[model samples]
Target: MGGGLTLDGLNRQPQIGNTRLQAPIGLAPFNSGMFGQDGSIGTDGLSFYRSFCNDRLGLLCVGGLAVAAAGRANRSSMCLDRDERAHGLRLVCETAHAAGVKVAVQIEHAGRQTGPHETGLPSVAATAAPCPVVGGSPSALSLGEISLIVDQFVHTAEIAARAGADLIEVHAAHGYLLSGFLSAATNTRQDRYGGNLERRFRIVHEIVTRAHAAVGHRIGIRINVHEDLPGGMTPDQAIAGLRNLRTKLAYISISGGMYTRARDVIIPRRTLSRALWRDQAATVRTELGVPVMIAGNIDTPELAASLLEHNVSDVVLFGRSLLADPDMLISATTGRQIQPCTDCGQCKYHTKGYPHIYCPFHPTLRPLRSTWKRRRTD
Candidate 1:
């Protein structure tokens, strides 16, 4: 993302007040393997990003590794092999720190969205219904199961901390496990985890509270301020939930849409629109008195600066933009107007059916470039 400024322009101006973006531009977990259908390893994902960004970027490692088990096949799976996950995280932390950047990891659970073929466990939600995408009926989770899920989240946080993550972003958005409970549309339970916003938010609150107690100051949450679903939590409801966990949360990251149904619409569209939720984030930041980070299609440095200048958000979380160009943050801060992501969604398309994920737009990954080099030698 370019800021329309030359190196001199950035150097001459007063320093950007918030140092959050000065170095730490978050790398989305990218969900390599574990829960994703593609099943790529976190290490491979980290290696690709580290090489591209030269380790001068913060990363939010995606979490879908089950931390609890109910049976043999239900055991928590690791996204990366034990050594690989730890090594990759250490590499990310060391490399980023050397370049003066910070890193965070996002903790998530697929919940009812987990395919039976994928997780080997029956998909369970607050209420039983047909799966949103595959159209299979699901079972309602028992209260005992709910308690286990909370423990799983806490365990995930602990694992993240051990993985050398600087921050822990609870994935309470995108109609995932936590979001399912929060959304009246998705959650129809008669228990404490359902009903009104307060009750609906109990599971998330407990997760955040336990996460904070476990990880202390390095806890945050990425939430969907508006689910964009019928009967889903609105912006106001999201604000209240965040407010309820004010003391427990360090920062609140704002995002929108339902991941299960609107995956394509959510990532590409939101990733490009810089102004999508600036106002909502500002309002949440104001009311909750916590640092707010806004993610969704935010591509350029100028857009990020504008958001901060207007107090719309405290930080910008670049997802696809970073995928397109890992050095995006460097170029933005250094006043270089590098080529921005075209937002063609080719990266997503490339991974749609492949066993291994690669960015077709990434210059280094171009087969033609390799062929050209070989031809030159010939």
Candidate 2:
């Protein structure tokens, strides 16, 4: 049913300032630190973003490093050594704010996906089962443990605020702890947190409600509108969940596909279409009465503008696209035809321990310089 509105047509009247962005496009908080081998231990990601964009962009959401930290160490580890985590948060806030971008920290827990050798604690999920990718059987969370996890989300939000983050987004997608609970395929719990869709969504509902109360207007969520898996939460179920959380959330960013299988990671040849999530985003925007952000293989400005023109989403979130070119939004808006990401899967492949992220299309390998020059020249 979607057609018309090319990228050039939308770029004819370019939106420059933050005010111009009806549903502002933004950079995703990718885990550059984890991907890079240096372990520099600061908000290098934020610094990189600021250096590239130069305070022009609004709404910069940091990746869920707090969840990564928690997964790397047990929850008690963070409780025991709050200083390091707090320090990390502080750096992220200062860098992003200094850049004039409203910063939001994504909070997550890997659940059964937790690195076994890293954390040592038994990975926990809504049920006892082996993670499809991580290759470890997780223990089903007890009611007490579930409560603890909820509290952990709240505590993390508090920490994010104290560290000066402008907003907090609960990572309820990508088969993380919250997503694990939300998906019927993953969560087989017989208790209140499982069974029907309502119960299955309780974990997310509780976390969002508590997180909103904990952080107020400064909270949002990145959700998987569809798991794209059999026996999992479908587009319809996800829309219901979004409706339920609308009041509690500041914004709802739509994302899908978990890295549990190779097919889920690669699109077109592997999954349905690269724009599968974009269509789902349109459904979400139609159903939910809140702002919606869409992500997933949206590498072209024309595609993004088409989505925006149709009111598919209030915002477009570019993860690998921005990793390739931080000034992608500016370039597109100003009618500059920049090279789009090829989606070769090299970024994901090299991200495991690569020193820096590079685009196969943009062969220079000088991301910072190229990004800064683009913004500076503009």
- TM-score of each prediction: 0.80, 0.81
* Weakest lDDT window of 10 consecutive positions for candidate 2: 72-81
lDDT of 1 by residue, 1-378 (tens): 245533232121111112243333456655533232222335445556455443334344454344433211122233422333455556666666555556666766656656565466566667886657645456788889889888877876786677676777777776666778888889888877788889999988888888888878778887887766689777788888778788878778887776556544357564445557777888898988887778776776566666656667656667667666766766766677676677665555313433333456555443423322221121
- Clash totals in order: 4, 3
242 in model 2: Cα distance from truth in Å?
Answer: 3.6
| Candidate 2 TM-score to native | 0.81
Clashing residue pairs for model 2 = 7-302, 23-314, 29-63
Question: Residue 191 of candidate 1: its Cα lDDT?
Answer: 72
Clashes of 1: 4
Supply candidate 1's per-residue lDDT for 14: 17
